[model samples]
Target chain A: AQRVTQPEKLLSVFKGAPVELKCNYSYSGSPELFWYVQYSRQRLQLLLRHISRESIKGFTADLNKGETSFHLKKPFAQEEDSAMYYCALRFMEYGNKLVFGAGTILRVKS
Target chain B: DAMVIQNPRYQVTQFGKPVTLSCSQTLNHNVMYWYQQKSSQAPKLLFHYYDKDFNNEADTPDNFQSRRPNTSFCFLDIRSPGLGDAAMYLCATSRAGKTYEQYFGPGTRLTVT
Candidate 1:
């Protein structure tokens, strides 16, 4: 079974503080991880994927196979960065469906 | 802009009533998906259409059905909606080879009264 776990439901931080959203996955096969973000009154959008390995909007996530985790990290949190973050695992044994974690609400207060 | 689009941002229907939600995409992607999301929860995949082939999740109920008449359009039909069926229905599209990155539309919020 492929599953994702985001332990924190709410992560509050002050502006300019470092932010890290923890995510862990359970899968038997090689894993493909992605981060999706939904801003207030906006549709969910792709933030980044583990395959790309490129940072987007000062946010980056590294896939850790040994630990079975892919935690999203940002050096500094901005007020505009507050949004709902979801960690998803792409399972291909089926038709390549994404299994998402419950979600984490990151609130960056200014 | 070429993007995924969903109709009726807000829909209210009586319990046991049949409702149809529409999704369209201008990206011309090969795969389109429908998901149900409840408050403060992850989006659950109901089904997806890759071209003309449809795939339904094992846990999906028979009360829900989907259609893809063409490549750019898909529809989700709820035969008899229950109170539990009320949720945000998200429509998404992605290319065949690169199905990892999905483009989601503004979801339709369904209310079952």
Candidate 2:
């Protein structure tokens, strides 16, 4: 069985400040990781995936297999960046199913 | 633009009443999934349909059922609504092959009375 964990339930930061959302996972085999974000009044959408190796909306995450972690980071948080973020892990054997973390609420204060 | 759509943005049901939520997609994707999301929690996968093949999570309760009459439409049926069943039910779609990126609908908020 695979599981994802997000230690922080709420993370508040001021605009223009650096922000980091921590995520850890437990999986025996090779895992695919992703970040999904849900903005106020909007449907959940993909933020970034480790395989792409590209940043989205100034945010990036690197998959650390040894540490079993994939943390999302931004150099400077924007007010509009406030949203709920979820970490997800996809096990190849499970087909299309994804195991997700409880999620963390990112609140960017002006 | 191609997109995933869900109907009845909000639904209110009496306890033990049978309720069904609908989802449709214009993207013509091969996979459609149903998820239940509680307050401040991650979306939990209840089941998914790949073409005509239906797959349910092992831990998912038997009270929940799903139907996909065709490639473009799917339905989630709650056999008997319970207070704990009240949550935001989301519908999502994804293409087959190596790309696992999924498109999600706005979701229907179900309220059990």
Candidate 3:
């Protein structure tokens, strides 16, 4: 079975500080990973994907197969960056059903 | 601009009553999905339609049904909603195949009284 795990329920950081949200996955076959964000009063949107290898809103995530992890990171956190973050995985063989993590609520304090 | 739209940002229904949530998209994406999200929990996939091919998750309850008449519209119908069924129903769409990113709507929050 494919599963994504995000152990942190709430993460607090001061503005301008670096931030990291951890995510891990378990799947036998090759998988595609993604990070999604939901800002206040906004719909959940894709923040970045491992396959894209690009940063969005200064957030970057590196997929590590060996560790079975795809943790989201940002060099400096901002007040506007606070939101709910979810990590997801898509099985290569499955019909593209996305398995999501429990999600972490990031609160950047000014 | 292309986007996914879900009607009734908030919905209140009596227990054991039937409720229908609607979703529409202008992106013309070939794939559409419905997910149920509870407080502090991950969004669980209920069902999805890929060009009218309906697929239901194994763990999804029978009371939860979905219909997709075309590429742009999809509807989720709960035959008899229980208190446990109250959650935020999210609608998302992705382009043909698996290369494109999924776009999500603002979601419909269901409150069962």
Predicted candidate 3 versus true structure: per-residue lDDT over A49-71, tens digit per residue: 89989989999999999999999
Give me the candidate number with maximum DockQ.
1
The candidate that achieves the highest TM-score relative to the unseen native structure? 1
lDDT of 2 at B97: 71
Q: Model 3, residue A38: displacement in angstroms?
A: 0.9
For candidate 1 chain A, which ten residues in a row score worst on lDDT? A91-100
Per-residue accuracy of model 1 over A10-103 as CA lDDT, tens digit each? 9999999999999999997888999999999888999999999999999999999999999999999999999999999997686588998999
TM-score of each: 0.97, 0.96, 0.96
Ranking by lDDT: 1, 2, 3
lDDT of 2: 0.93
Q: What is the lDDT of candidate 3?
A: 0.92
Name the regions of candidate 2 deviating beyond 4 angstroms.
none
Find the 10 residues in a row with the least total lDDT in model 2 chain A: A91-100
